[model samples]
Target: MTEESDSPMTDTDSTTTGPLVPEDITADSPFTLPGFFAALAEGRLVAARCTECDTHLLPPRPACYGCGSRAVTLSEQPRTGEVISYTSVNRPPSAFDHLAPITVAVVELDSSARLTGRVDASLEDVTIGDRVELQVRDPETVDIDPDFGLSYEEEWPIHVFELI
Candidate 1:
């Protein structure tokens, strides 16, 4: 499949894959703008860590929410995590119309930080506490393009224990 220039990074799929975003949808990002895209571009799952409580926070920030510590550090997270909760967006927000019925999951990293992403499996197959791996899928493979550096999708293999 052809790759899109705007994708975070292209990954070869043994099977056919689809784009994560459609050209029709247009909306501003809801999360931290540059830092989010930058992490994907660099192939690292960046998160904020509290120096005081040692809490790893997703959506990296300048301060720690747990201990109210300003001394925070940004670190790359392990790509594997456990699915704490998830939902299939059959009716997505206006901006995600191109990707309706997508699976969004809250994943708990091994470090105990919870982060969210689109789940890359069928709705019937995903379950709470399922093991998942972070992956960067090319938009062109799916026939859509997100107006960002790259869009990522999380895939959960059948064997959940493997992630640990």
Candidate 2:
């Protein structure tokens, strides 16, 4: 099998060129969700924690988006979680129509941070209080707005949770 990428073959060129930003993969910050994606690429699940209150932020924010605190740190989280809320989509958005009946959910990790992610389990089997483990799956290509530079456009992975 083969595929084609319209993204810049290399971002070092003097002329900054890019195809339409590809889907939701575009990330613009390390202190934001992209930083969590980067860590997922490294086979780790990390969250932002407030040094002041020890609160965990699932999609990390530089400053504790939770409490208006400037003391935020990326802290790795426990891989296990339980389903808090979820929905099974009969029709996914255009980009993901091929994956209908997808289960998307908000899972509360053991550390008390709730994260929204697609659950990788048989649709019929998903339910509230179901035990799951955070897992990383390769995204094949990571894309981002051209202004941020190519460092953000490498092969990487994102987090998904599997029923345990």
Candidate 3:
């Protein structure tokens, strides 16, 4: 009778290999929604522009919303923008309780793309039309994810903005 080993098996199922390691996860496309944001690690604020309608997509999409065109191009935008609107979170959510009194603002990028991000300013300092500059932040420091359905982690970059 042979004593069986409980160790992990290789592709050939020899069982001589130790525990199997997880496969490396990666994005499908460099211009995918997550991929665009991931570039922030390099201090870049990139967006997808529709080739047909010439509309820029902030979160990025495969198809253009204006004309339903499948042709999209990802590009970096001017790093400055004006604050369109904003709100403050005094009673923060579970993931942001440590960062209460956080001010979130919608900024219209110089290229006409609207992106929401946290501003480093007091309540009195923030106002509509105020010029703000993009500042890449360690995602954990910002502790907020503008991308709905995707959680922000320390490894990702947070495209934060500050009044200029």
TM-score of each: 0.63, 0.69, 0.73
| Model 3 Cα lDDT, one tens digit per residue, 1-164 | 01222221112212222122333123533345456557667766666676667677776555578787756666567778789999898987666666678889999877777889888887789999888888987755565544422553436676678998
Cα deviation at 53, candidate 3, in Å, is: 1.7
RMSD to the native, candidate 1? 13.8
lDDT of 2 by residue, 84-129 (tens): 9888888766555656777888988877777898888767899888
Q: CA lDDT of 150 in candidate 2?
A: 49
Lowest-scoring 10 consecutive residues by lDDT in candidate 3? 8-17
Better of 1 and 3 by lDDT: 3
Predict model 1's lDDT versus the native: 0.55
Off by over 4 Å in 3: 1-28, 143-154
Q: Is candidate 2 or candidate 3 better by lDDT?
A: 3
Most accurate candidate by lDDT: 3
- Whole-model Cα lDDT of every candidate shown, in order: 0.55, 0.63, 0.65
After superposing candidate 2, which stretches have Cα over 4 Å from the reference? 1-34, 141-154
Score residue 55 of candidate 3 by CA lDDT. Answer: 77
TM-score of 1: 0.63
